[model samples]
Target chain A: MSAPFYIGYNAKMPPATAAFLRRWVVALFVAGAGVAVALAGLQHRYGDGQFEFGIVKSFDGIISESPYPNLIVRRPIGTDAKDVRSRVLLVAPGKHGAQELVRGLEGRAVTLQGSLITRDNQSMIEVRPGTIAVQAAAVAGDDGVPLGNFTLRGEIVDSKCYFGVMKPGNLKPHKACAIRCISGGCPPVLVVRDADGMAVYFVLAGSDGGAVSSDVLDKIAEPLEITGEVERQDNVLVLKAEPGTYRRLE
Target chain B: MTLAYQAISWNRQKRVYDTVMAGGVLTFLAVFVVTGLVLHSEITAEALLIRALGTGAFLLLNVVLSIGPLCRVDPRFLPMLYNRRHMGVATFLLGAAHGGFALVQFHALGDVNPLVSVLTGNTDVQRLSEFPFEWFGLFALVLLFLMAATSHDFWLANLTAPVWKALHMGVYLAYAALVLHVVLGVLQAETSPWLVGVLGLGMAWILGLHVFTGWREWCGDREHAGATADGFVEVCAVADIPENRARVVTLGGERVAVFRYDGKVSALSSVCRHQNGPLGEGCVVDGFVTCPWHGYQYLPETGASPPPFTESVPTFAVKIVMGQVWVHPRPNAPGTRVEPAKIG
Candidate 1:
C-alpha cells in the first residue's frame, strides 16, 4: 500500500501561493472567532411561557389540585367562602423530591420560599431545591366543596408546555411533543371540564398516590376517561387515579 | 509526507479550511437564531439553537459527500477534497452539541434516564408517520463519530488506503439515516415545501453525480481501442494534450498520464502514489506534475518526487511518430528515467 498523497499538502509550492493561503487562513480565523463570541454572548434559556426566574418570595396557601396531582396553593381571602374562590396557585421546579413532599402535605397550608413566576396570568411558585416547609399539620381548609368522583374526559398533557411553552398543549397535533415532555419528567396534567362546564386542570397522581410520571408515558395526548376523587388543595385540584381505572377511547 | 505523526500536520490550506468552516457554523447559528426570533417571534432561543446546529451539521455532511464526485466531474473542485477531514470533524462537533442539548431539553429532568427516555418514550412505531425517528439520527451520529474519530493520517496510515476509504465510505449510510431522520422528524410537522424540495433535490443531485461520473468512466475504459500488437499503441494525437497538462488514456491495460510539457511529451502511470488519485487530472506546476488532489509533485521525466521526497510512479516508454504519441503497454520500473519524445 502506497502512503497517502495528502500526508503533506503543497510541500513544494511557489512562495506567492503559500502567502495567499496563509492570508486566507487568517481571514477565516478572525471571522470565525468573532461570530463564535457573538453566539456565546447570545446564550439564553427561554422558559416556556410558564416559567420565569425571579426573586425568592415566600407565600402561604392551601395546596389544591391544579389537575392530576400537581400542587396549587389557595390563599384565603377571609373566613367567608365566597372570597376563597378568588385565589390561584402556581408551583414549579417541582424538583428535590417535590412530588412526594407535596403529596404528604396534601390539604395542609404550607409556607414555601422560591422564585415566583406567572404564566398565562396564572401564578406558580418555583420552589427552590429543599426550601418547602409545612406551616401546620395536614388540616382541611375552607377549600371549595368536594366536586365528587368526577368521571371527566380529556387528553393528559405535560404541564411544561400547556402552561407556557406551547399555547395549546393538548389534542392530536401536539400529541407526540407533549408525550415526550411528560416522559422526560415534566408533570402530567389532565385537561378536563367541570360540571359547571368550565375547563379545569387536575394534576394527576397514581391510585397509590405516588408520582405517576412513568405510568402515564403511554397515555399522553390521548383522550381517556379518568375517574378519580377530586379534592381542593388550597386553590388547585388533585385527581387521584390508578392505571386500570383510566380507559383509552382512541 | 512527514516521517512522524503529530495530532495534525498543520498546513496553510488546512488552517484556512477549518477556520472558514468554523466561521460558517457560528455565522449560521447567529443568523438562524436572529431570524427565527424576528420572523416567528415565538420560538424559544434554545429551540432555534438546536435547529441551527442540527441543520449546520446536516448541510456540511452533504457538502463533504459531494466534494468527491464533484472533483471527478470537474478537477477545479479538487481543492475541496484536500483537508476535507477538517469539515467532517467540525460537523461531528456541531452534531454533538445538538444531540447533547436536545438530550438535556427533551429527555432530561424526567423520571427515566434521558437516553432511555428517547428510546422508550416513543413506542408508537406502529404508525409509520409517528415512528420514532430520533433513533435514526442517533445511529447516524454514531457512525459519523466513528468516521470523524479515525479521520486523521495516523489511522489512515495504519488502516491503509483501501481500508481507510471503505471506513469513511460509511458516510453514505449516515446520509441515508439523516434523510430518514429529516423526513420522519421535522417533515412530520413542517409545513414548508421548500425544505422537502431542497432535500429531494440534494439527494437527486448526489445520486445523479455518482451515476453520471460512473457511466462516463465505464464508457471511457470500454472505448480505449488502443490494443496494439507488440504492446505499443497509439493513445492520442500529440495535439490532444494541452500544453503543460496530461491526456489520460488506457493503453496496454494501464492508465497513463501522457504530459505535453516544454515542447516534449512524457508518459507516466496516471495513478498517484498518494491515495491513488488521478494524476492525469492535474497540471504541471513550477516544473513538477502537481497532483490536483493534494499538490503532491513528481518529476515528469523520472515519475518520481523531487529530491528528499521518495514517492514515485511507474514511467512508460513513449515515442512520437508523425505527431502522434504511442506508448508501450508495459510499465517501466518506478522512478525510471525516460527521455521525453520531442514534439514538432
Candidate 2:
C-alpha cells in the first residue's frame, strides 16, 4: 500500500512464464474432493435397488381375487379390524402353477409359505413350490362377483417408486423410469379414486396373476380408463381387466 | 519445457486467483447443503452431496465450453480464460464425486463387483427406452478424467499443440454423453422439469455462441483480405477502425491486427500467446494490448509482455498512405519496439 499506486498498463508478462498453478491451491481442491468422497462412502446407505431379492416370510390370509383369475391374501388389518387393500398380501402363484393351487381355494382361508418381496409398501408371496396349505375348505368367496363392471380412470404407476421411494413418481416426468421399473419385474399398480375420491392402489395381475407387469408396461405413468370387473376380495379390492381392456386417456 | 516439467510456476496473482476460486467452490457446496437440509430434512447426506457435486461439475463444464466463443465475441471475458484449466480439473473431480456416490449407493454390497454391477445392473441397453443411461455418464466421466489428467502444459508440449487441441476437443463428445445420461436417467426418475430446462438452455447457449463467433470471424476474414500497394497491404482507413478498436487484415498468409488507439496505429499478430485468442477483437485497455481470451497483455509497439511476464507476439510495421492504413507484409521479431505510425 503506497501513497500513489503507480500502475504500468504496458507491463506485459511473457507467455512462457506460464506459472504452473500453486501446488496448495490444487492440494486444497484435492483435499476438498477427498472429503466429499469420504462422506459419501460413509453414508454407504445402500438400497435394494429397483428390485428386492426374494426373502422368505410367513403370511396368513384368505385367498381372494381382485379381478385376476388368481388370488391375493386378504389379511385383516389387525386381529379384529376389517380387511382392506392396503393390508393385502398379493399372492404370486407357487412354482406348481396358478390353476392347480387356486382351483377351489377362492373363498377359503389359506396359508402359503414362500419367498416374499415387497415394494411401494405392497407385499407379494411367491409360494415355495409345495408350501401352500388350505386352512379352510372352499366356500362362497367374494372373488369378483361382478360387484360392478364399468370404465374406471386413473394411472398405472410402478408401485415401488410411486408410494414412498420418490415423491410424485406417478407424473409424466417419471413416465419413462416407471416403465423401466415395471419392466424389471416390479408389480404394476393402478391408482384410482373410489366413490368418495380416495386413492386406492390395486396390484395389477394377469387372469392368473402370472405377470401383468409386461402387459401394462406401456401404460405405466399414463392416465387411463379400463373396463373391468371391480370386486372386493375380503380386504383386497381389485379390478380384473382382460388383456387390451385398458384405454389411454389424454 | 522438459519432460519433467514443474507442476506450476507459482505467482502472487495466480495464488490469489485460485484461492478465490476454491473459496467459491466451498461456498457453493455449503449453500447447497444448507438449503437441501432445510427443504428435504430426510434427504441423505450422500444424496445431497452427490447431487450438489454433479450440478456443480455440469455448471463449470458449461462455463469452460462457453469461454472460447465468449472471448471471441468480446475480450473483456479473457480474465476467466486465464486459469481455465484449473476449472476443468475441478469439474472432473466434482463429476468423479457424483459417480462415486451413485456407485456406492446402488451397487455396493451386491453379489457382483460394484463396477461390474454398474455395467450389468441396467443391461436393458438393447431397448431404446430402457437403455443403460448411467453408463453414458460413466463414459463421460472417464473422458473428463482423461482431460483433467492431461491438462498440464507438459502434456501440451509433449503432445504438440494441434494434437493436444484435438484430444481436448473430446469434451464435446463427453458433453453429448452427459446430455443423454441426464435425459434418460434423472429426467425419468426425478419428475422435475426445471433440470431439463436448464440443461436445454445451457446447451443452446454454448452451441449458439460458437456458431455465431465462427460465422462472424469467417465473414470478416474473407472480406478485404488482400488489396496490395507497394510492399504493404492496404487495410481500412484510420477512421474505419473505431477508437481503441482494430481493423484486422490478412496479408502474406498472416493475420495482423492493426489497432488504432490514442491517435496512433500499431499492428500485431492476431493470435494471442495464451490460447491463440483473436487479439483483433480485443480493444486496448489502459494502453496495453489485452488478449480477448485470457487478458494476457502486450506492449503494442514492441509486442513484448511487460517485465517479469516474458510473453510476446510478433509486431508489424503500419503506415498511413493516402487515407488508408497499410501494414508491411513482413513480421518483426516478437518484442521488437517498432515506432507506432501517427494517424493523420
Candidate 3:
C-alpha cells in the first residue's frame, strides 16, 4: 500500500494517518502539561506581603502632611520602648496618597475608616472615601531620634503598592506602576536590604525634610546608592537625602 | 478546494485538529494555574493569570514556528500543518489576554491613560536592564493581532498570496520582540537559571529545525542540476520518480515538480497558489495534484484547478527522451496547459 495522504476537505483521513496523528496528539498534550508544570514550578517565590482587601476598621490618630501624608497613633499600653508611637502611612482608595483627604487636618486629632496593608514592620492604611472625622486639635512635637548619617544601597518603590496593594510590586515589572503611584502623590520609599535579604523601608524626603515624590520619579525600581540621614519617628524611618545625589549603581 | 469563502471550511480533520489544539491549551493553562497556586499560596490572582497566559502564548508560538520545518523534514508531520492557522489565531487570543490583564493591573488605576502609560512608563533606553520592555510586548501584540485578524481565506484571496505570505512572516519579528519582552521584563526580576535555560532551549530548538530543513532542501536542489540539451534540461529518469509521485528539480533558479502518473509524466510549478505552500512535497491524489499544506488541488497537465475552483500554478513543458525526463527552463503563464510526456 502507498503511504497515507491527508486531504483536509475530505470527511475522513486515511486510517494510517489518523492513527499516527492520534498517537502524536496524545504525546503533545502530555508533553505540554509537563512543560506547564515545570515552568510554574520554576517561578521565583512571591513577596510575603498582605493587603487586607475589603476589611475596614476605624483608626484614631494625628494626621501629618509634611514629607507625606501619614497618621500618628499612640501605641497600646505595653509595647516596645524604642518607639512609643506607631507612624501609620496613609493612602487614598486608588493609586494615590491621602493628601487630598487630609489636606487641612495636620496637627489635628482625627478618626478614619480604612483597610490595612502591611509587609514586615511597615504598615499603611487605604482610607475609605469620606470617612475622616475631624476632632479637637492635639499638641504635636517634631522630635525624632536622628540616627547617624550612612550610605545605603537599595531600590526606590512606591509606598502605597509596595506595602501590599500589589504582590511582588517592587521590581522592573512593577516599575511603571511605581512611577504612576509616586507621580500621583503616593510617597516614594527607599528599600534597603540587610545581608540576609530582610528589607528595611525608609520614606524618602528632600534634604530639607519635604516630600520628594516628584524628585525621585525617574529613579524608581533600580539599584540606587543614597547617602542620607535616617531619623526614627515612632515606627516610621525617614531618609533625608537630595534626589540629585542618588547614584545608580550598575 | 473552496469555490467561495465561508466563515471556515470546517472538515473532519480540522475539527479533530482544533479539538486537540484547544485541549492542549486548556491543559497547559489549568496545569499552570493549579500548580502556581499550590506552590505559592500568596500569589495574587492578576499576577497568576498574566504569567500563565504570557507563557502559554510564547510556547504556542514556538510550536507554531516548528510546524512548518517539521513538515519539511518529515511528511508524517503534514497533518499538523493542515489547520495551523487556527493555532496562530489561538496564540494571538492568549497573548491579548495576557496583555490586557497586565495593562489593567499595572497601568489602569494610575493617573494617565493605560496605553500612554505603557509607552511612556520607563524611558531608560540607554540602559539595558531598565529599558521599557512593555513597548516590546505591545509591538508584538499588534503584529499578532494583524496576523490573526487576516487569517481567513477571504483576506488571503483579497490580499493576494505573496502579500499575505509576507505579512504573516511578521511572526518571526513578533517572536523576536516577545523574546526581548520576557528577557528584559520578567527575567530581570525573576533571575532563575532554570527559567533562562528553558527559554534558551526553545530558541535553540526552533533555530536547529530551520537550519536542518534548509540544509536538506539546498542539498536536494543542488543534486538535481541535470544536463541541458535542445532547450530542455534533463530533470531525472522517469523510473527515478515513484508512481503517482513527483521528483522536484531546480532549473534557472525556479523549482518544478515533475510528476509521474499512469504511464505519463508532467511538470508544474512547485509553488502552490495558496499561501505559497511547497507543491513539490504534495502527492498526486485522484487525478489531481494536492497541496500538502491545505489540500489545494491543481491539474498536473494544465497546472489549474478543476472547474468551479480557480486556484492554479504555472506549468513547465516536459518531454521524455530515452527514459530520461527533460523539462524546459522557462515557465508558462499560470494555468497554461502543456502536453504530458508519455513514458516508454
- Among the numbered candidates, top DockQ falls to 3
> TM-scores across all candidates?
0.77, 0.60, 0.97
Candidate 1 residue-wise lDDT, A64-171, digit = tens: 432322343443322344434434434445222234446556667677776643443344455565666777777653544456787879768777666655433455
In model 2, the number of clashes is: 15
What is the C-alpha lDDT profile of model 2 across B288-310, one tens digit per residue?
88765546688889998887776
| iRMSD for every model | 7.9, 11.0, 1.3
Q: Candidate 1 at residue B277, lDDT?
A: 80
Which of the two candidates, 1 or 2, achieves a greater lDDT against the reference?
A: 1
Chain A (alone) TM-scores for all candidate structures: 0.53, 0.50, 0.93
Where is model 1 chain B poorest over a 10-residue stretch in terms of lDDT? B35-44
Alpha carbon lDDT of residue A168, candidate 3? Answer: 74
For each prediction in turn, the share of the native Cα contacts (below 8 Å between chains A and B) that it retains comes to 0.09, 0.02, 0.72
DockQ of each: 0.16, 0.06, 0.73
Q: By DockQ, is 2 or 3 better?
A: 3
